[model samples]
Target: MTPRRIAFYAPLKPVDHPIPSGDRQMARLILRALEAIDPAEIGPVEVASGLRVYDGAGDPAAQARLSAAAAAECDRLLSLYAAEPARRPALWLSYHVYYKAPDLIGPAVAHALGIPYVVVEATRARKRLTGPWSAFAAAAESAIEQAALVLCVSARDRHAVEAYGPPDQQVAMLPPFLDLPPAIDRSETASPPRLLTVAMMRPGDKLASYRLLADSLSRLAAQPWTLDIVGDGSAAAEVSALFAPFGQRVRLLGARPPADLAAHYRAADLLVWPGLNEAFGMVYLEAQAHGVPVLAIDNAGTGTVIRDGVGGRLTGPTAQDYAAALSALLADPSSLHALGHRARAHVEAHHALPAAAQRLRGLLTGLMS
Candidate 1:
C-alpha cells in the first residue's frame, strides 16, 4: 500500500536551524516525530512567515514594503498549493492556526484541495477577541470550522475547540511526544544539580518569565543548584541582566545544538519553566524522557505535561510559588530521584514517539480511507 503523503505546514519559520522560541522547537519536534515512523511519510512540508510587525527606529515606509513583500511571498506559496493536483497530498497538517494572513493561506489552500485539514495546538478563548490578537482569533475560528481534525495538547485547548462546535470527528487530544536522544551514562553525583530551562529570551512577556525565574532562583541562593539556560533571542541582554546577580549559579549557554541539548537533558535533574502561557510544551516530555522532571506553572496547557506530585510539581504562576516548589524539591534529593524515575516512566507509558507516530499514521490512514 502506498503511504499517505502528508503535507505539513508551519506558519512560523521552519525549525531547520536553531532558533529562539517554543513554536519553532515544536515545529521541529512534530517533523521529527513523523519522520521517526517513516521518513517518506511527510512530503514537501512548507512554512509561511506569518505576519510579523517590526516597530524599529528604521524607515517606516521600508518596513511597510518589506511586510508587503512577505505577504506576497505567502500568496505565491498558497497559489502553488492551489495549483497542485488534488491527489498530491493525502492530507494537510498545520502546526498553529491563529495567525491572520500568512497562517490562513495554507489552511485555505488545503480546504480548496479537498484534503483533510488537521490543526495542532489550536485555541479559542473569548478574551483573545479583546486583545491585539483579535484578528488572529477570527482567523483561528474560521480554520477550526473547516478542520477535519484538531489535535489539541491539553484538555483546556480541547474544550476550547469543542466550544467552537466543531464536527464530532474533527477533534483529537494528542499530547506532544518526545524523540529524545539516548540517555547519557553519567553518575548523578558527578554533576551538580543541573536545572535546565530551554527557551529563547524574546522581547516580550517571555522576558518577564525569565525575570521571574531568575528571581525565584535568587531565593534559592543557599541551594546547590545551577541553571543552564539554552536558546537566544532579542532580549538576550535583558535576560543576562536578570541572571547577573546569580553569578556562577546561572549559566547562559546560548542555543546549543540538538545533540548538545539532549546531553544537557540527560545530565540534568530537573527542568524549570515558569512561562505564563504555552500551547503544549514538548520540552517537558524531552526532559522526562531523560529521567528529568519538570517544574512549571499549573496554568493552561502546562499542567497537562507536569502532573503534581507524580512526575513533577505544578505551582501557581508566580515567582514566589515557583521558588517555594524549587526549594522544597531541591532540599529533598531522594524525592527528586523518585520523581525523575516516575517522570521517565510516565512519558514512556503515555507519549512515546513510536506510539504517537502510530496514532498519527492511523489518523492519516482513516482520513484517506
Candidate 2:
C-alpha cells in the first residue's frame, strides 16, 4: 500500500534556509522528524512566499503593499490546494501559529482544504491587541478550534490549547525532539570550563539576555571559564559589544553550520541560556546530546527541557541568580561532570531522533487510519 500522504506547512520560511530565529529551527526539526519517520509518507511541504518587507520607517503605504502581496501569495497557494485531488492529504500539519498575518495563511488554507488540521508548538496567551497581528491571531485561533490534533511541546502550551475547549483526546503533548550527532571525545581536550549558548541575538528581550550574560560573567571574571556564543541576529553588534569587556574570555562564533555547532557542543562543558521568555528551548537537548548540561531560568515552558539537579540547574529569572548558579557549578567540576553524563543519558533515552520519529509516525498513521 502507498504510504499516507502527510502535507506539511511552515508559514515562516522553507526549513532548509538559514533563518535567524528559534522558531525556524523548530520548524526544520519538525519537518525532519516527520520525514525520518517515513520518507515516502510526507508529501510536498508548502513554503511561504519569501517576501518579508519589515516597515522600519513605519510607512503605511509600504506596509499596505507588502500586506497585499502576502495576501495574493496565500490565495495562490490555496487555489493550488483546491485544485489538487480531494484525497491528496491524509492530514495537514502546521508549525508555530503566531500574531503575524502571514503566519495564519497556512492554517486558513488547511481549513479550506477540509482535512485533519494539526498544529505543533502553538501558543495562545498573547497580549498584543493592535493592528494586523491581533486580527491574524484571532483568525488562527478559530482555525485551531477546527483542528483534529494540536501537538504541544510544553505543558504551558497544552494548557493554552485546552483553554480553547478542544477535546482532551485531540491535544497531544510531544516534547521538542532533536536528531543529535554522535558524541565527541572531550576527554583528550585540556580546555578550560567552556560555556556555550546558541541563539539568535534579536532586539528586545534577546538583547537583554546577552546583557545579563555579560553581567554574570563580569561577576565571575576571576573564574577560569570561557564562553562561546553561537548564531547571529539584529543585535549582533550590541551583543558583541556587551561581551567586549571579557575580551578573549567570550567568543562570538556567529551562526556556525550544523557540523561545527555539534563539535562546539561536544567541546563545551555547559550551555547557558538566560532568555526572559521561551516557548521551548531545543538548544538544551542539542547541548545534552553532546554531554553538555544546560543552565537556564526556571520559566514555565523551560521545565520540559531542563531537568533540575539531573541534567542542569534551573535558577530564578535573574542575572544574579544565574551567576550564582554558574559560580556554584564551576566550583564543583565533578558535580557538573555528573550532571553532564545524566544529561546525555536523558536526551538519548527521551528526545533522540529515532524514538521521536517513531512517535510522529504513529501519530500520522493513527490520523490516516
Candidate 3:
C-alpha cells in the first residue's frame, strides 16, 4: 500500500513563508521530520494542503474571514477526496497551535474526513479565554480538544496543554531539535570575549529582551567585549537606539541566513539574550550546537534550552543579576571555555535532528497503523 499522506499546516507562518525566523524554520524542520518517517521505507511521504490562512496579528475579523475560507477549502478537499480516495490525507498535522494563530481549518477538515489530527507546540492559557483574543483562544482550545495528540516541545507547554487539553487527548513531550551541523569544539575563548545575540527586533518580549540586554551590558561598560546582534524586524530603529550608547562595541548585523549566523556563533565565545518569557528560544540551541555558551534569564521557556552552569548561565530576571553573571564569566575565561565544551556535547546528545526524527517516527507510526 502507498504511504499515508500527512497534511501539514502552520497557521502562524506557512512552511514556505518568505521570512527567516524561528517559526518558519521550525515548520520546515517538522516537514522534514515527518517525510523522513516514511512508514514503509518507501520514498518520502507526501505533505498536502499548502493553503496559508495566516492570522499572525490575532485580528478577529481576519480570523473570521480565514475560517470562512478554510470551510470552503475543506469542502473542496472533501469533494476532491471523494473523487479520488487514494489522494486523501490520512492525517492532518498542524504546527504552532496557540491563541494568536489557531488551527481553524484542521479540526473541521479532519473531523469531516475521519482522519487522525495532531498538533505540535499546542499551548493553552486560561487568561487568554477572556482577553481580546477570546474567540481565537476558544477556537484554539477546540482544536486541541479535537486533536488525537498534542506534541509539546517544552515542559512548561506540556503542563499547560495537559491541564487544559481534552482528557482523552494524548500529550507527549517532543523536545526542540534543530538541523545542526557537527558540533564545533571551542576549547579556547576569543581574545576579547566575543558576545552574540540572535533574536528579532519586534515589540513586546523581543524588544524587552533587547532593552534588558542593553541595560545589562551598559552596566558592564568597563569590560572589553564585542557584541554582535543578528536579527531585524519592525523595531530595528528602536533596537539600534537602545545599543547606540555602546558605539563601536556593538555591531548590528541584522537578519542573516543560517549559514552566516552559524559562522557568528562559532566565532563568538558567549551568547547573551535576556529571552524574556520566550517559548523556548531556538537561538540558544543553535548557539550551543556551535559550541557557544549562552546567558539567559531562567524563565519557563528559556530554562528548557540553557542548562545552568552546564551549557550556559541561567540568571535571575533582573539587570543586576544578568550584569553580574556576565562579569563573572568574563573574569573566568577557563570556566567559560569548559562551559562551551559541555554546551556542544549537550546539544549533540539531545537536540540533533536524528533524535527528533526517531521520536516523531515513534509517535506517528501508530497513527499510520
For model 1, residues 1-369, the per-residue Cα lDDT tens digits are: 434567776654555544545566777777766666654545434343344433233344644454566457557756765576433566777776553322454466566566788887776655655455555555557777678888888898888788875456478877777665565443452246788898877866578779888889988887788888997888999998999988887899997766677778877888998856766577787888888888988887777777778778889878899999999988887788888888877888887778877887676667866
TM-score to true structure, per model: 0.83, 0.87, 0.95
Ten-residue region with minimum lDDT total, candidate 3: 38-47
- lDDT tens string, model 2, 45-98? 444344442443434465567567666866986676557654356577877755
The worst-scoring run of ten residues by lDDT in candidate 1 lies at: 48-57
The candidates, ranked best first by lDDT, are: 3, 2, 1
Q: lDDT tens string, model 3, 1-369? A: 544777788888887777788888888888888766655632244545566666657577987887787778778878887898777777788999888877877898889888899999988866888857878888888998888999998998999888877788899988888887775556588778999999999989999999999999999998879999999999999999999999989999999887688688878999999999999988999889888899999988988778898899999899999999999999899999999888888988888888888898888777867
RMSD of each: 4.1, 3.3, 1.8
Alpha-carbon RMSD, candidate 1: 4.1
Instruction: Output the lDDT of residue 226, model 2.
Output: 92
TM-score quality measure for candidate 2? 0.87
* Best candidate, lDDT: 3
- Overall local distance difference test of candidate 2: 0.73
